[model samples]
Target: MRYLVHYVEDVTERVHAEAERARLVAALAAERGQLRAALLQAMTPMALLVGPEHRLELVNDAYKRVSGGRDVTGLTYREAFPELEGQPFFDIQDRVYATGEPWAATAVPVRYDRLGAGLEDAYFDLRYEPVRDAEGRVFALLSYGVDVTEQTRAHLAAERERQRLAAVLEHLPVGVTFAEAPAGRHSVSNPAAVAIWGVVPASPEVAAYSRDFVGFRPGPGAPGSPEEAARRIASHEWPLARALAQGEVVQDELVEIERPDGARRLVSLSAAPVRDADGRVDGALVTSVDVTERERLLAESEAARARVTAVLESIGDAFYAVDAEFRFTYVNRRAEALWQRCREDLIGRHYWSEFPAAVGSESYRMHHQVMSERRPVHYETISPLTDLWIDVSIYPEAGGGLACYFRDITARKTAEAAREAAVARAEGARAEAEQANRGKSEFLAVMSHELRTPLNAIGGYAELIELGIHGPVTEAQRTALARIQQSQRHLLGLIAGVLDYSRVEAGAVTYRLADVPVGEAVAEAEALVAPQLRAKGLGYAWSGAPPELHMRADREKLQQILLNLLGNAVKFTRPRDGVPGRIEVACTVDEERVHLHVRDTGVGIAPEQLERIFEPFVQADQRLTRAQEGVGLGLAISRDLARGMGGDLTAASVPGVGSTFSLTLPRA
Candidate 1:
């Protein structure tokens, strides 16, 4: 029985051992299936095993795609993918395998650029885990990763797109720039931008040909120097900078910029702020267009305006402009002179302050009326001086303004008054003279009739005596009757001279004109003045061309002019020692006219009174003691007659020296 029990125990131990072996087989198979499926689901997790290490004991199809490998069976890592053997990725895997502990890392941007242009650089998130045998020894490593190459490539592509856009903007023909909004600070710039600035030409040819700008400055009142200006620019402090910083459009803000040559250029800068998606100003886009021509035109226009102002100041008459409030807006040089006010003192002040309130009252009213009615007003008023008359006019301007013009007419007014008084005196003198002339004519007529009556009776008696109607008287008695006749004729001659003078004053002098020899006329006048010359013991001398050379003239008037001048000369001459008293009459003719001169080498005219001697009712002296004994109308009448005959009479003399009087007449 004991033997039988021992055999049973041995059998039981055998059964238990066999059952444990079966359970172990089933668990191993199930775990293998799960790991294989998991590798397929998470391909990158098993990518490590099939890498260039030829460790393909476990891996997925994803490892093949990433590695770009084909079949790797029965081959070492060198044979499978020789290029990957010494790569950085392989080195990282070796470390993971040696560590035997799980590892994961991030933060460093990954790079993988083995692909071509269409398929470029990618990134990854990698992990490695240790797989342990039942005995706790690690023989393999499990790697898990994500092929983030697409994400990395997409990010890189977006960056490239932005660069391309910037490049395109910089290379554009017109200069383009971006600055900070409200603070124009220069940021990143492209090669083309640097070239346009002339600060840093990137292209080799451009750099060689152009000068680079180290920086900009405000100088005294501008921005900063070129070097520091960049900072101010980056900060956006300039006009363009401010507008840009403020996100506003800057339109044609004229700015003076000092160029490299230390010259200023007028520039018109236009700018606007560029905003980001968040609606914040990122920078300003700007363009600067030079407008020096426009600036020059503006300066010229200003100079022309100043010239006009100067011209207005130079006119002779007072001129000024006034506002509706009677404020002086503009006053010219004459205005200031006439008002005794400074231009500065009155330009902005009331016009009434320039003159006394009591004075220019009419002018003040006219100014107001013109402005109020928008019409012109004119009047004649006494000047503020109160001694002169002025004609003043005020005209309204388009916009409630006024212009005034004034001219002084004091001389004209005085002349008019003198003319009226002279007319009154002439009328009075004419009435008195007419009454005196009537009395004289009556006396002369009665006297002539009384004297001539006796002469006629005597002449009749003589004729009867001769005819024997009565016995012939003795010869002596007949001669006595003839003497009476001659006396009567002389008296009539004196009356006729008086009547001729009166006729001239009464505007009744008659003239007969004919062609007469200038020389012959003078000889006849010398004959008439012969008696006066003989009385003064002066010689009567005549000079000129022959009588055949004639002058178209009133022959009687010419004789009268010559006789009057010669008679006056004979009257003035007095007998002197060795120097003969002489009256010289001379006449000469040219192609067109004849000149007759009456000269006296006798008592000469006084120099001081030569011109006055020609005036009627005037003589060198009023005293009756003077040798001259006739009314002072001879020269005046001669001048009048000469002018009437389209000729002129003139005289020249020296005190105590002989005088020459010339009469010019037109030729026949």
Candidate 2:
């Protein structure tokens, strides 16, 4: 029974050992399958079981693709890729196999003949490793590689581009500077940048480089002094340092710096962040420009503008300037006053808009004419706004503009219009006076002719009865007849005077223009007036008469004028206060005229009545009961007849003293 039990235990132990062996075998097969499959289908190129003789024992699909479909399995390395026989790749692999050491190659080059394509070059990251048995004795070499052709070419291209950019930054005309981020290293600069910064174009760590930058000083009114400015640059407190440290972008920051020659230069600077591939700020690129000349020119232009403004403001006339479009550019104080607005309201405003009613007015037309013709124009126009007349002068300026100077002339224009109205009225009154004189002369002519003939017949009958061809009259009858005759003669004389006055006033009197001796004319006038003078018992005198004095006049008109004036003097005397009135006749001759004067010493004309005495139908004593016997036509007719003979009659008188009537005629 013990033996049966032992047999069963042994059988159980054998079955268990067999089961464990089978499980071990299955695991080994699975591991080998996984290894083979991983090699054959790997994206990376792989070769297995390569001998020390440099022969390829196994190759994967990736290796086949890298070899351009060339069958390289079971072939020696030299046979598979003959073009690579003299290269360092095989030597590197042989060294790995002989020493049983693994080797790595980065970006190694290899060339091989393709299956259907031509020979081509490729690059790879390769690994050569020795495969050893269980006793650690190397039997075969394993080679694996990554196809890094695109990456290798990309690295080479990036290196070339970096070199080219460095050269460009070094030679660019504008100042260029580079600063490394977080390091505060302003290590790169071109020649222009060094000149702008007044610093050495070297590494930032060098003391001289930082010291050279210390010479930079802030411009006037800046935030810092020279020492502070240098500290800002060195301590990364400036815009360039801020851009690199904080990844900030700064543009067109104006600053002034002291140059090497002890002169200040104005600079405009711009800075931007330079980033790495990981989007981290790596450095900053800064550019600068010198703007000193530009600033100086701007300041000069401002000064010149102020000078011109001062001149314009000081002018007297109302002055304004406008562009070609009639938009006001400048307006002075006087111009603002004339426009009744402020200068700020007028400047940059259209002319027509400021004065809307002047759009088609004469002033506007003249301005446009001057603009078109490129000349100057002067004109006067009435402003509808103020109702004032304006005298304006417009001049064309240099730059398609206009300058206008103007003033108000309303007062002068008003005075001229008033004078013209007064002259017109005077002309109208003179015409009316002429018409009235014509009517008076016509009435006088009819009365003189109608009454003179009847009065003359009565005088002739009275004379015949006084002669008495019918015989015998008593003294009383004779006396009555004489009185009747006297009345008849007086009526006849009055009629004749009316007839003479009518002819003279009507301008119908015939004139014989002959040279009449002045003394002879006075003698004839005295004889005609002597009867009246003696009857009134008036004293008479004559002096100042030159025998050689002659007058160009009508002889009869001259005698008639003198007779009327002397008779008026005799009739007015009336022996006042028992003093006989005196009459004087005199003549004065000048180069151009002859004057005949008749002076009366009794009942002189009043000062106010002298001018009225020469007017028709005017009398010295204007009452009906006055002592004067005749109508007041005598003096008027005398003056008219004197004027018709190219002469004038003027009278001067003082009341209660004397009167003088002078007849002036043009000398022959």
Candidate 3:
């Protein structure tokens, strides 16, 4: 040992060289320690995978924390993250190890069963670097990752939202458009916008929007031509442009647009400024809806309303409309005239306030009832204000209102009142005339009764003188007595006829009605008139009535009527040119009546005097010198008797030919 250091030549240099080497080695180890410490404490998740199996060799605190603090050291990547077996991460790492090329991935999704918990998904930005031997062959992989789960999930969610909005905009029914601020240099439109515009135009600047969009403003003083429309819709005037320039929100601005195909459309455009986070207008959002049909329908409805108003104004009847609160909404000209107030004054005025007197009248009651029941009512009432009768009709409106139609009937009411008064006066005059006629009939009845006794006494005295009961009489005296008796009988007959007429006129006569054979009554009349007919040399014939053909009349009255008719026929008829005058009786039966016709070949009555012959004391021979029989009272009495017993007597006559008297009686 003593001999080893004896020949040490410049050993100090050798010792110094060894010391420097050690120092260098210690510094390198320290630096490596600091690097390892920094890597472990760093917020970034970092791990080292070694060998082809990609076994986890070293893991920092951040990496362990990211792995849920699982002990993944010395474990293969596949074993550490079993859920990642089928994931691209495992294969990506293998490729990075085999290729020895540095690899990086952003938002690489991984599944890890952290701390024996269920596998949870995490997003990461991953980096894989190959660790090579000195021979330059890939041996191990170094994997470092940042747990970018929250950032990556947020980015993915935003991307999904953008895609969803894109899809929605594509299919939206309402047209939507977006334009960038600062003159709208950039613009985009949805499919609906393209459809609404009829063609998708190139994106245009804000200044060119008016020229490119081809729209017109509507209403009064609107553009009359295409050039005018273009000029009117200036760039700054457009809804979208206004929103972008002035930060204005324009809603439901109706614009008429002419499409490229020459078809026009009405669009309801709404625009709002799209503000940035700083509350500065950066863009414009526009929505458009096609309202052409709606606008057209509204215009048609307005026209119809105008037409209805015109008709209401032109109608004669007063017309007015009232709301549910009884406030007047509209009034026509007639209504204004009837109310004696201007339409401007009546409109929007309460009905009861305008006509205070009618507040509790029938008109008010009916109006309330109609409104409540939604029914129509018609009534007539006197106007409280004008004191005129009015016909009112109230109809319920569909929208909780009422329509009223009224008319002034004052003129008609006045005329009706006047007519009723005239009718009353006429009725009084008729009553007075009937009373005078009854008085005259009473006077005639009393006078005729008073004359009948004197006439009968004169006739009895004349008969006694002719019989020579007081003294002897000559032939001349007997003839004179016979003449006096004849005159007395004729006078008595006239007085009896007058008395009968008076009784009939005074309604004092009575009748006993019974079914009498018409033929039997006619035969009895013929017997009574036979003697007179023989004296006049007139032929008479009777038509036998059927036994079953009976007349419902008083027997005595019927016989009297027949006798009078036959006697008149015999008296009026005279032989003309040696031809004997003839009288004929004919009987006929109808459904409910029997007619007895007495015909005579006598001078017929004048057409004008046909009716006058039936009057009392009137005859065909009206001259005082005429040779016809006594007064015409026979026919009048006969007609009165016939009518008293449910029968009528009528006559038809032809001048210079013949006369026929028909007696019509109810058949039994």
On lDDT, the candidate that comes out on top is: 3
- Residue 382 miss distance in model 1 (angstroms): 11
Model 3: per-residue Cα lDDT over 158-226, one tens digit each: 999999999999899998877677565326778898777664536333345534442345533233676
TM-score of 3: 0.48
Please, what are the lDDT tens digits per residue for candidate 1 over residues 302-388? 999799788887766678888887788888887677666788988878777666653447776777678878989888877764446
lDDT of 2 at 616: 71
Q: How do the predictions measure up, each by TM-score?
A: 0.39, 0.42, 0.48
Q: What local lDDT score does residue 257 receive in model 3, on the 0 to 100 scale?
A: 75
Better of 2 and 3 by lDDT: 3
Q: Candidate 2: TM-score?
A: 0.42
Q: Which is the winner by TM-score between candidate 1 and candidate 3? A: 3
RMSD for each of the candidates = 32.2, 36.4, 27.1
**Candidate 2 lDDT, tens digit per residue, 576-656?**
677777888887878899888888887788778887998877898998799777767788888888888888999998888
* Candidate 3, run of 10 with poorest lDDT: 214-223
Global CA lDDT computed for model 1: 0.66
Best by TM-score: 3
Candidate 2 ranges beyond 4 A from true positions: 1-437, 469-474, 509-512, 533-538, 574-581, 622-625
